[model samples]
Target: MKITHYCLSALLLFAVAGCDRLEQDMLSVPDDTTLDRYGLDTLKLGDKRAEVGKQLDALLDKPMQCTPGKTGLGDKRKAYLLEECSGVPVAGEVGKLWGEKLSFFKAVFVEDQLCSLELQLKTSGDYAALYEAHGKKIINLFGKPDEANAKGVRWQREGDEAVLKDLGDGNISFEIRNKKVVQALHHKG
Candidate 1:
């Protein structure tokens, strides 16, 4: 009787260990390099609108002020403005550099998923300095710009784009957009 009990206990332990190993194997991370590289605050391309909204709420720690559009791509998407970072009232170190002079962001989503993020400077300081500072920051994150000019600097990876544009007014635009969505919008237009 004692030997049988010991054998049953060993079998149960082995079964549990095997199940854990199988679970780990089944739940391995995906091999898509773009997915591995492209993400912000738990938000990523192709996420469902509801999921992105939840993440936005979690990141902002408050229900964001959202405006739904009635025309254009805005019809399929919603915009949220000026959201601060999660778990912090103020922007982080890097965010502070641009956030100080820049107004809050305008985050855009299509079919309920984030497709673009835009930020406008409330007051364009020395255009040279603003461009250089944010340009360096974008490069640091996304590698060298694919296109750089007086108008703007653009960096792209896996159909995702980042642009820092001097719109030639007090308004400076920093835009990150999903390339696929941009193409779709252009095609519609």
Candidate 2:
């Protein structure tokens, strides 16, 4: 059993490497100009990231908000995103950078005139604790993502709601939210 696990792990590593190359190809699909428009640096979260105070404003905005589209790519997807994304991103999605559905995240966004986006992570135990531990820092960053590297930081605009798009590849647009994912877009992926 130990040998089997080790072999599997090695295979997984190789697979990840191959997938990384493929992702690079996919990302290259969008030229630098287009990516710049989307704001995915993949190197650093530039100065356009969302702020916590701003997130509060979006959440408290005087209009109805929700997940916006469909729900539960599967029972697992629904559960996975709900665990990490509770109230912030109107769109809900969870997965690793490769964009598989296993409850991992790296970025988030808050709506408003700025439409700030930030990074996020999966938490264990309590949501409040998770928020305090990582959420606060993400909010303070107040920057946007680098899409040239496949990092989902699609800059901001007031009422410019966030959305998750899986380019039909392992790579995905992980929508990191400032607060709980109070709403989500209801569509099948």
> How close is each model in CA RMSD to the real structure?
19.3, 17.8
Q: Please give me the total number of clashing residue pairs in predicted model 2.
A: 36
Per-residue alpha-carbon lDDT of candidate 1 for residues 79-165, written as tens digits (9 for 90 to 100): 322222222234421122234344445566655666776655545444334433443333334544456554565666777877766
Error of 2 at 64 (Å): 10
lDDT of 2 by residue, 55-173 (tens): 32333212212332233432345522211122333334332221222232223322311122332333232323332333223222322222222222232323232333333233223
Best by TM-score: 1
Clash pairs, model 1 backbone: 49-112
User: What TM-score does structure 2 among the candidates reach?
Assistant: 0.22
10 residues in a row with least lDDT, candidate 1: 7-16
